[model samples]
Target: MKPILYVGNINYSSWSLRPYIALRWAGIDFDMVEVNLDQPGYGDYAIAEILAFNPAGKVPALRVGAAVIADSLAISEWASETGSSLYPQDPLARALVRSAVAEMHSGFAAVRRDLSMNIRRRCKAFGLPADTVRDIARLDALFAGHRKHAAEGPFLFGQRTVADAFFTPVATRFRTYGIELSADAQAYCDTLLADAAFLAWEQMVLAQPATGFSRANIDRLYT
Candidate 1:
């Protein structure tokens, strides 16, 4: 049976973007079902509807036959099919990728919360909270540390993996908030932002009606 990926707003959902990118790179064909988180009158009531499929009440849920999988990382794992690491070959590489993906999955709450993800908007970054600054610094350091693992390609693993997919939303957050990065890290972010799948997602976001959610106005609803 064909899988159905229920995604949230591409403009604001970093979690949704993660599994979608993983699915794209894995060349796993699936139908995308968008769950609009808010609407003219519904506000956040629309978000609660995801409980029908995802008990967690979050998006990026996947339906495979009779089984429903929630959690962005879980869905991404299914897409990659090499465990959470998504790199099927070398043990060391797989472990490193897993560590990185796991870090993205559960850590960096500061960057994830403060910067957030607003793919279609750009803003001057300033007044960053101390925790957020530290998060960005750690992210930059991770980018530098992980680059040596990639002996060839621009991606973290020499080829795109679920780790890179996990990082894509952070890259978008960096861009949207104008968060400065080290040159190498910025280049990595640039690569993610220019990825064809991501570009297509951005275009799709452009076509959708404005939800009136931006970092300038809405703080948490878009996330």
Candidate 2:
């Protein structure tokens, strides 16, 4: 049986986008079910539905037969085992990729909090918080270092890997918030935004009906 992936709103669920893009990039075929996270009664209905599969009651849960895989990184690893190009062959390179993916999975709280992923909305003249600025700088440095060692590809560590999938939402965040990036970082974001899979996701996000929920703090930052 083909795997089934449960996702949340494409406009705001960065975690959901991670595995969705990873599976697409890895050429893994799967069925996707979108849960309306912004809808009324989401906590009681959507959360309950997701909790049946994932104890954490989170989006981006993957179900393969009787086994359920929770978390984006876990799903990415599973895809790699199935001949997906989610990691490198060399031990050292694979380790580096894993490290990057792990950092993305756990770090960048300020960026995630301050600039929530809203693909459908673009804020104008939004000044980032000090912590978020620092996070963006770190991301620039990380992308630069990886680009230097990459093997003739636009993606980090050369070609599309799990690391790139993990950071894809960050790229969209940079665009939505009008955050400035260094040449290398901007190019990396450009490459991701230009990807067919990413574009398809964006199109899907745009097609979705608007959710009434809004982030007041983020909106306040706008001019």
The candidate scoring highest on TM-score is 2
Q: Per-residue CA lDDT of candidate 1, range 136-205, in tens? A: 9999998877777556788877788888999999998888877788888988888888899888788899
Clashing pairs in 2: none
Cα lDDT listed for each candidate: 0.81, 0.83
Residue-level lDDT of model 2, residues 1-223, one tens digit each, is 8999899877888999998988897888899898767544454544666777877777888999998898899998887777567887899999999899989999999998887788877875456688888998999999888887545688998878899999999999889888888898898889888999899999988887866444235444564
Q: Looking at model 1, how many pairs of residues clash? A: 0
The global Cα lDDT (0 to 1) of model 2 is 0.83
Can you give the TM-score per candidate against the true fold?
A: 0.89, 0.91
Q: What is the lDDT of residue 7 in candidate 1?
A: 86
